[model samples]
Target: MKLIAFCSTGMRVAAVAAGIAVLTGCGSLPLPDKPQRPMVYDFGPGLPAASSGPAGAPLALAQVAAPAPLEGLAVNYRLLYAGSGQQPQPYALARWSMSPAQLVSQRLRETLAAQRPVVNVGESLAALELRVDLEEFSQVFDSPGASFGLVRMRATVVAPLTRGERLLGQRTFTARQPAASNDAPGGVKALTDATDDLARQIVAWLAELPVPQGARPVAPAARP
Candidate 1:
């Protein structure tokens, strides 16, 4: 009887040890980590509806071209005091919905369409063309606490020809607006305001140009 009791006690101890070992192994396993999502931003202020303007041959607006740094969707900024030679750096957590060039082109097209007839590059038939080169679009920090949004672009008007496109006129536009704050949201607002001003200037410049031969002139009633 004594031997049998002793054997039973040993089995119970072994079972308890096995259960503890299993629990310890499970506790040592690592849990899966959660992924972080980036924030996306875009230009604000709703565009106005298209208004009646002078009847004319459809003008073509090409996609704006930008340098490699501005070509990406990332929101970029410059630390002027860090080093004049340093290239602009992008915010890791914030990004634009589209590239700066694309946004500018969209804004220009919408603004122009409201003033006159405009179409995409492929739709225009021997019509006047508008090409844009985006040189700068960034939030520049003059110091650790002060900053501004800067924008610069070159606009060229081209007359389509049987053989090649002829340059009719060209101009460069630059604008800077103080940021309400030193962060991405503030930069966006300033850049948007700058773009609005630039668009207005371009429209005024186009209004002064002589109507193309095939294009109809703006009626006095349609003139803004």
Candidate 2:
């Protein structure tokens, strides 16, 4: 019994020593690492729906020269906004940036199509020409604590084509809009709100235009 007792003490001491040595040799295992959070950014809702509408056909020459408004009267010429000459920025998920020039052009095109005079799909059918040149298209980041949006833009109408000649009279237009910007998710609301207002202005001005008549029409065979 005495020997058994002695042997048990010896085993306990041995076990303790072995455990201490293993722990000392292994320096503590690295603590479990904390997970990192993802960087968050915002973009507008999903990309616009794919266009399922009909393809656009070319306007006939007859449509182009159909008629001319009285002298000093502005004819409602077909509209065209190609989104050309400007670079549009790519949008990221969760972040709604200002309108892309192409996007803006598209919106303008659709708006006019829905309301204004017959807008040509391209410049070929346009009679009284109104060419818009985007002079500025950029969005600056709001500095920390700033409460307003950072969007600004400038554009000029470079020409008003009347017949074979280009009319250069009063050919400039500009628009600007900013909002109570919060770095918070809702910041984008300001941009869209302001944009809506600007769009209304454009539609109103174009709606008042006089559409020309008496212009020659292209035969249906010539229509694309």
Candidate 3:
């Protein structure tokens, strides 16, 4: 009797173990983890908006007279591939795989014309050339998401190539703006603001500083 009972108990244990193994193999005993979504930036929260500035204008600091009249001014930009220098780099926006030269140039052009009083490079065929080489244009987002941007650049006005006289004194501008969001729209706004902020800085700089003589000062662009 004792032998029979012992064998029966052993057989039951073996059966249970086998059943467990089968269940596990079929994943019946192994529940899957909960499905998860990838992280993304939010457009709300600390992100700034177009109206963030006064009367829908971007944030502005100081506005002074151009050191001298860019009277004979003709503006042209390079909008080159900027390396790592500032915040919210457009390249970084796209995972640092592509270049944002065109976007940056467009933004710069629009901002200079709309925000401040500068000579038109095209209509006038002016003498001085304001050259800008963007060194860095990127954003930084570790864990808080893409919330901050930096724009590093170098600018100078060269006298007509024939003159070989670069403007003396001051001719450079830079700006940084942080973008933070828990979402997507916020990230873009932050990026936009980043661009706006930099533009304002550049405009302010150009406004206050004197332009190198470029075919004598010409009339400002006709008011639109």
Point to the candidate with the largest TM-score: 1
What tens digits encode model 1's per-residue C-alpha lDDT throughout 1-224?
A: 99999999999999999878776886555567887666888776558785566455467787888988988988878999778526788877778888999899888888887877887665646357777899999989989898888999999887766555556799999989999999888888888888878888888887776645654222111111
Candidate 2 residue 28 C-alpha distance from true site, Å: 9.9
Q: Score residue 14 of candidate 2 by CA lDDT.
A: 100
Query: Number of clashing pairs, model 1?
Result: 0
Query: How far out, in Å, is residue 48 in model 1?
Result: 1.8
- The lDDT for every candidate, in the order shown, is 0.79, 0.37, 0.45
lDDT of each residue in 1-224, candidate 2, tens digit only: 99999999999999999888777777645678887633333233423433454232211111211111111111111111333313333223233232234334544554444443435434345433333333333332334344332223332221223333333223334444443543334334444444444545655654444435433222122223
Winner on TM-score between 2 and 3 is: 3
Predicted candidate 1: what Cα RMSD to the true structure?
7.3
Worst 10 residues of 1 by lDDT: 215-224
Best by lDDT: 1
lDDT of 3 at 161: 32
Off by over 4 Å in 1: 1-35, 50-57, 214-224
Order by lDDT, highest first: 1, 3, 2
Stretches of candidate 3 off by over 4 Å are 1-98, 115-124, 142-146, 169-172, 182-187, 211-224
